[model samples]
Target: MISMIMVLNQKGDIMISRQYRDDVGRAAADSFRLQVVAAKETGTEAPVKRIENCSFLYTRHLNMYFVALTRSNVNPALVFEYLFQLIRILKAYLGEDFDENAMRNNMTLIYELMDETMDFGYPQNCAVDVLRLYINLGNVRPQDEPEPSQLTSQITGAIDWRREGIRHKKNEVYIDVLESVNLLLSSNGNVLRNEVTGQVQMNTKLTGMPECKFGLNDKLVIDKEKEDRKPGVEIDDCTFHRCVRLGKFDADRTITFIPPDGEFELMRYRVTDNINLPFRIIPAVQEEQGMTKVSINLKVIANFSDQLYATHVVLKVPVPKNTAKAKIKHSFGRAKYEPEQQAIVWRVKRFAGKAECHINAEVDLMPTVRPKPWSRPPINVEFQVPMFTASGVHVRFLRVYDKSGYHTNRWVRYITKAGNYQIRI
Candidate 1:
């Protein structure tokens, strides 16, 4: 819960303020401005700060700080979630690049939205779609405005995410399973960190209140089967959308929900076991003739199936900051020395699986006045492979039931990309 919400500029000047309770006074604003922003204290870098009895929880968007003040002991996670949701709602109303000028132009509209989204220090309905039904920037006559009773009902309704009487001529659904692979390899080829995070995104355009039951090849689900149990992905943890019925999922491991219209992420999961890395990078750097020149050799091998391929593969290998010039050659793809980046940047448009590529670079270093040792930063790699999942996660089945009994079309896709993928030299 919050006592007041304030939008302050980068200089700690209050741009907007809304008070829900009188327990927290205007002095709280000055406390944050002086103690947190003006002082720029390095004792604590946390988003939540405590000054006196009031707790200040805040997040920065663009050039403004959206701060929430509270006197009661509030759930930090919930407060942060509400802050982010507020940002999403503002972005929906305003443009993606909304800044100080945009907020100054729409001050009244912003106040109205803040009033409706939160009431008496408690978060109310913050759904953008639901709020858009009643609130608008354009002027409307009394007769043209939606009924107040209906708006109240929608706000308090169980299915606040979806509006009633939603109809579409063609009913169809699309599911995309996207995964990000993160790895940290030691110089001696030891696997330091390897993990995969994935999310299931859905785009649904269906009529009526259709109930959908989704299934996945999860280890927990497969382990419950007394017979014909198959190997499944070992999921460390998962989080679902608000529309999902958590009770049903807890009882039977069934993902049941009346999905929201348009596009939304259905679920996100993390996996640390049995991750299939798509690429193996081997790098060697040797100084030649008393650090006058350095020779760098890098080999990249695709580890996936031969039928698959990665697109827009890139690698960045760092060089000494005192390097003057470099000559590079590669078996495949393009390589060039970037003086500004102090690294050799190599890129390949399309790389086939079961293939290997090599790059060799000879860098000449200018003697530094201080003669400090090179830090030798890690090599970073980036790529995207379609129809692949590092966690081996697969959709088992998706069933839909509706009163209209109309035929529906469904499609599923999978993709995996690199994230924080680094190899030490």
Candidate 2:
């Protein structure tokens, strides 16, 4: 439970403060500025800080800080989640660039929104859509206002995300499975770290309160089936949208939810086991002639099917800081020495699958007084491939049910990209 909410500027001065409960005094707000924000400036990751009987949970957006003070032992996740929700709600009402100036102008409306979202010390309806129905910056017409009974139902309803009577002529559901592969490779061709983070994004245009049941080729379900006992993609951890019935999913490995209108992320998952690496980078760096010159060779091989190709592949190969010039050559991409970055920037517009590309560079070092050894930085890579999943995860089925029993169209697309991918030279 939140006792007080405070919005502070970059200098830790209070901009907008609201007190929900009298348990925590106004001095608690000062504690956050002194202890939390001050410590944060000195490279401290204090998202939650306890001071004098009050606990402060805060998040920073631009130059403002949203903080919550609580006296009781509250769920930290819920507090942080509510803080994020408050930020989104304010952005929805105020424009995206809502800064100190905007906050000053709409102080009254912001306070009203704070009162509506949190009652006493508990979080209530924080749906932006529902709040916009009654609360408005401009004058709301009598005809535009919803009935009292309808408004009450909406605020107290189980479906907090969606409104009633949504229609579509051609019902369609678009699912996009996007996975980002992060890899850290050692100099001796060893994968130090390999991880794939993925998300299921859905764009729903179906009418009525349609229930969606999504299925993935998960190892848990495969083991439960007990047929063939073949292994599936192992998900380390996953989080679903609030609309999903978590209790049902816990009982059975079945994902079921009543999706909101338009586009929303259905779920996010992380995978570490058996990651299908798309690219294999082999690097050889040699210091020639007593560190006066350096020779670098790199081989990039694609490991996917030959049918699909990757686009906009960029590889940053680090060079010495005090380098005179670089003579670089590549087979499949354009390579140029970037002085500011101190690296060879290579760009390949189209990289065919099951293909190999090579790069050779001879770097001449500039004579320096101290002659300090160069610290070789890791090579960073970035690319995107359509119709591919680095985690080898596939959607088995997507079942939708509604009272109208209308026919719906569904489309599924897959994309794999590089994220934090690096190779030590």
Candidate 3:
């Protein structure tokens, strides 16, 4: 349970503060500003900080901090989640920079939001659409509001993310699977650790309470069905949105959920097995008599869709602090030395599928009196492929149904991007 919610700016001024229960006093607020904000407490440590008898769980968004204070033992995860939701709601109303000005101008609406979202230290309906239906800049008159009974039922209903009687003539659902691959390679091009983080985002424009079921070519389901089949991609862990029925998913490995309106992240998952890497970086560095010789090569192979091309490929190669000059030769794109970063930045406008690219740079550095090993940092690469998933995760099916049984259109796309794709030398 929460006792107080406060928003503090960078200079420690309280932008918006609300107390849900008397268990927290105004003195605690002053103390938080002094002890936490004034002290410039770093967030690398635990998020939950205890000052006197109160526990504070806070997160920063934009130039402000959203803090929740509680005296009792409350769920830390729930507190953080609620704080994020509150930020989302504020951003929805205030556009960009939902900061002091936005909150100050809409103080009444903020108070209404705080009261409605949390009552007696428990989270209520915090959905943006639900809150916007009634709470706005001006007061919502009784005549302008929906039926109290129906609104109340929607708030406390099973599917709170969606609203009632939503309509879309197109009745279309588009699912996009995006995966990012993170890699750490040794100097000899041997993989140390590799991981793929993926997210499934959906843009739903269906009407009349459509029930949806999503299917993935998951290893667990495949193994249970066919024991002799070759093992496919395995998901290490996954987390779904609140709309998904966890109990139903646990009973049977079925992803059944009532999707939220508009755009939302349906699910996020991690994969570590059978990752089809799209880029391989190879590096060779040597120390000459009076200068350093650096030779680097990057190979971006399009592993899927030979005709499709990857766009916006960038590779960053770090250099020594006292680097004198660099000569770069590349087959495609632009490569130049970035003096501010002490690194060579290379960019490829478009890398074709089933194609390879290479870069070689020779650097002449001023000799130093004290010889030391160049603490070479890992090379970072970033690229995006339109129709490919690094883990080869495929959506087998997406079935949607409603009481009205209206015809619906569905579309699916896959994308793969680099996430800390690094190589060390």
The estimated TM-scores of all candidates read: 0.93, 0.89, 0.92
Q: Residues 1-425, candidate 1, lDDT per residue (tens digit)? A: 79999998888888788999999977788899988888764235889899998899998897788899999999989888888988888898898878988888989989999998899989988888787878787677445344778767767889988876778989999999999999999988899999999999999998988999999999888888656366888899999999999999999888999988888899999999998999999999998766779899998999989999999999999999989999998998999999898889999999999899989999999987677778899999999999989899999888889987889899999999999999999
Note the residue pairs that clash in candidate 2: none
- For model 1, the stretches where C-alpha displacement exceeds 4 angstroms are 39-44, 140-148, 225-230
Worst 10 residues of 2 by lDDT: 37-46
> Which scores greater on TM-score, model 2 or model 3?
3
Query: How do the residues 1-425 of candidate 2 rate in per-residue lDDT, one tens digit apiece?
Result: 88999999888888899999989876776677787777675236758787898888888888899889999999999999889999999998888778988998999999999999999989887877678877888775555466778778767889867767778999999999999999999999898999999999999999988999999989888778776345688899999988999999999989999998888889999999999899999999999766789999999999999999999999999998888899998896798999999899999999999999999999999888887777899999999999999998988889999998999899999999999999998
Positional deviation of residue 55's Cα in model 3 after best superposition, in angstroms: 2.3
Better of 1 and 2 by TM-score: 1
Clashing pairs in 1: none
lDDT of 3 by residue, 1-425 (tens): 99999988878777788988988876786787787777777476677789998999998887787899999988899999899989888888887566677778888888888899998889888878778667766654655356778778877777767877788878999999999999999988788989999999999998988889998888887767684364557899999988899998887788998888899899999999888888766676766665566555555455656778888988889988778889998888999999998899998888887776677788877778886777888888889998888898889889998998988898999999999888886
TM-score of candidate 2 to 2 decimals: 0.89
TM-score for candidate 3, please give it: 0.92
Q: Among all windows of ten consecutive residues in candidate 1, which has the lowest summed lDDT?
A: 138-147
